[model samples]
Target: MANTVSAKKMTRKIAKRTAVNRSRRSRMRTFIRKVEEAIASGNPNEAVAALRAAEPEIMRAAQKGIVHKNTASRKVSRLAQRVKALVA
Candidate 1:
């Protein structure tokens, strides 16, 4: 229970932020899934295009604190590697 006025306001703010973050996180995952699907389908062009779209979304999620910076970079690296392998 938030008794203080400031605490109550903070709680409300937190709830709003939580909803926004959840939406952003879900969107980021959707982009990642798209990239994975493109990769799994084994079309180099599609995979490359999907990666191009997803990379920025993943990085944005990290920037917004939804994921760690290192985790974002690692994910991008692995996905890029897979895409490269598919191309080769």
Candidate 2:
């Protein structure tokens, strides 16, 4: 449907970028899920460690433009709070 050469190139590029972003987002979710699982199991030490590990991955996804900065910050804040509660 793209008659222009540039448009065709852009479509191809977008498809590639979409695949990459999808994978990045999926990986980020996996990290978050690990932390959540640790928290749900109620092990403060493991939860804390999982949160620490997940934090950077989430931030990195934001930095790479795969996710919004506020979204990443909110997730980290909530996870940290939950971990802290587990400690208390």
Candidate 3:
């Protein structure tokens, strides 16, 4: 469909970027899932540790444009709250 050489080149670049973004997104979700699993297990210490590990990953995802900045912050905030509640 891309008739121009430049357009074809852009398509290829976009595909490559898409794969990279998908990988980063998957990695970020895995981190979030780990935190959720820790929370579900009801171990306050483990949950806190998982959150600590995930917060940076989430922020990094935001930095990389995989997720919105506010969304990342809100997610971290909610996870922290849950961890605190579990601790209490």
Q: Give lDDT per model, in order.
A: 0.96, 0.95, 0.95
lDDT of 3 at 54: 96
Top candidate, metric lDDT: 1
Q: Give the per-residue lDDT of model 1 (tens digit) for 15-59.
A: 999999999999999999998999899899999999999999999
Task: Tell me how candidate 3 scores on lDDT.
Answer: 0.95
Residue 70 displacement in candidate 3 (angstroms): 0.5
Better of 1 and 2 by TM-score: 1
Pairs that collide, model 2: none
Of 1 and 3, which scores higher on TM-score?
A: 3
Identify the candidate with maximal TM-score: 3
| Stretches of candidate 3 exceeding 4 Å from the true structure | none
Q: Higher-lDDT candidate among 1 and 3?
A: 1
